[model samples]
Target: MIRTVEVREARELLDHLLPLIASPWLYVVVFAIVAIDGFIPAMPSDPVVIGLAALSASGPPDVVMLAAVVITGGLAGDRVAYLLGRTAGHRVRNPKLVMAKQKAERALRRHGGGAILVGRFLPYGRTATAMTAGSAGLPPSRFTLHTTLAAVAWATYAIGLGRLGGETFARSPLLGAAFGIALGMVIGGAYTLVERRRAKTAAEEPEPELVASGRR
Candidate 1:
């Protein structure tokens, strides 16, 4: 009974909050949040996007537009990072970014295309991979192609999740947003853990050495 009452209250609260944020300005906000998050991983872009998507799922907002905005924003930010990396090269001074760059380079070397795709799902991984690819002098055409695909896939996954969650709790946008955000975080966290383990295992393996053959 208490659970039902709480859900009812939350739904009433969301009904009041939705109209204010569900305007044309919402798309602009989504774009800015996603683009900025690409450069600054600490930003709560995922939650913002998911929350907006949940709202859209429940009412007048266009989910497709939301997805498109996020994809464009993400790609634009990634391109900016890539250009910076290309221009700055190995002279990056920030220790944290430097480490991320190095890890991205190694992942690219070992995994090639897969690394770019997988990196999109992780918070810091996307920026690091794009920047590292640029710094490593990867061809612009190749990087664009790979990153575009990754962005599309990532955007679709996030938007779809929000839509599903919202539809499930159509009466309560708050519940929908919470569920969607939590699920996205869980998926991202699991992927990051797996990637880290794989990277560690790879690092521990020794490289094969070439042996020259001689006539006996």
Candidate 2:
């Protein structure tokens, strides 16, 4: 069933599921989005988190509970990435991405848990930091402790923005804006992926040669 799932349909299903989010179910959405975001770099969780915050105003879920679930979800999702980095961390040899990640790992070595704390504010850093910690052989307990704190701060800020949107603008307007922003990001990301692939292919090919005597 998962094999046949289309991205648009999956997103639409998520939209339908959004209104039903309340009580325990809210946690499910939080974890799902966070997990997907951590597992796949392309999936954006900020809008989903924000959208959930907006929904909370009308649903049975309260702010405190919403915040807690979001933090838990984000932490859970991040842990998976950390483990992946730990297990297969050495497999990724791309100098471009690796050099960036190495800087984060070096910081982890110097600052210990402090690196993860600072990494929370960064986009790519958040996931790479976790991997860096794991790869650096940090203890699980220490990783979890700092990661939990970071997750709470991250979720709070994201959800707060969503809540602010719901408060400042009407629900319909906020939802429309959020949807447009999400769609734009998706298109931009897809275009980037396609362009990168084209560039990579072009770089691998041989250049055309000039005619030998101009009389073939």
Candidate 3:
């Protein structure tokens, strides 16, 4: 995967980004990016947070503060996205998207905040789930509670990953940050592949026949 052009570009980008985040303004950058990521699925918040956290762990004593900032930003962004969904839900004219939103609504209604918590881990899952929740008229208090839980879990996991990379490459925090990002990509890719295989297998598998019941 590191041999791929995308990976190389990502490496270069993170390498460039890591240095910019080392200053006293690190907190602001982390918070802004994490918050922006909540509504913008393409924002790539994970890499930035991972990189900053790696540097923080290796060079500074502020990783704890970083986590707090990230969680706050994440919660803020999620709320904004939820509100956006509520306002824009009716404006969605695409049939496919509408159908998808309907399905999401059903799932959210049935499962409650668990769906929101789960979505926070999946790529682009948080934005979609949050928006759908708002659109579906899920209560604000419930959404906030679940979003808070998800933010904490996500922040802790991301920081831990960064810390692992930082500790592994203590001599070169930049390389460690890159490693963390790459590791995250590999994990996400593997999860996606496994899910696809599961879906395919389920689709292909035949249902059991009820011979004992004497179905005609």
Candidate 4:
């Protein structure tokens, strides 16, 4: 019941914001949402980007402008998360996160730029890759270059999905909204399942060091 209510409330909130996002200040709103959403993992910026693309279908702003806004918003949002990692990298010592630490460091060391480029396409990859890159002490210029390129590709893909919906439904905003929500739910659900599986596997695994040392 509570979960359903929260979903309903969230849907209502997104619906309420549609008109506001379509306003002349859309870019500013998107930029702010994207930036904050990255820092706070729960909030998603994809819906707003898709909304803007839908608005562009019947509206005044150019598609290019919408795309630019989405890209800028994403990059800005990622930077906030990246900066957080850069500053707080030392203090974060979670066993789960730490388990991935060596792999992340190895990725950067071996693959260098390509790993960061491809990692951006992943769900938690953007922030996680950025955080790992920071923790591994990758150069800022290299990190920014890869992140910027990845952001452009990601923004293009997201906005393109909305545009495809917009064009397919004869520029109908309703269709775009539907597509965005559906995609968000699917991706969100998949992410949840992956996390649960990872947790389960981690819980089931024996501690190699403890086993070897006969401590358990």
Name the best candidate (by lDDT): 3
For TM-score, the strongest prediction is: 1
Q: Scored by CA lDDT, what does every candidate get?
A: 0.70, 0.63, 0.72, 0.60
What is the C-alpha lDDT profile of model 3 across 11-54, one tens digit per residue? 55555665566566767766887898788655667877776677
Per TM-score, what order, best first?
Answer: 1, 3, 4, 2
Q: Model 1: clashing residue pairs?
A: none
Off by more than 4 A, model 3: 1-22, 92-103, 200-216
Candidate 2 C-alpha error for residue 15, in Å: 2.6
Residue 183, candidate 3: how far off, in angstroms?
1.0
Per-residue lDDT for 91-175 in model 4, tens only?
A: 7565544544444444555466556665554444555666767655666777778778977887776677667666666556767
Clashes by residue pair, model 2: none
Better of 2 and 3 by TM-score: 3
- The ten-residue window of minimal lDDT in model 3 covers 207-216
> Weakest 10 consecutive residues, lDDT, candidate 2?
207-216
lDDT of 2 by residue, 72-100 (tens): 77787779878978898887665644764
Between candidates 1 and 4, name the one with more favorable lDDT: 1
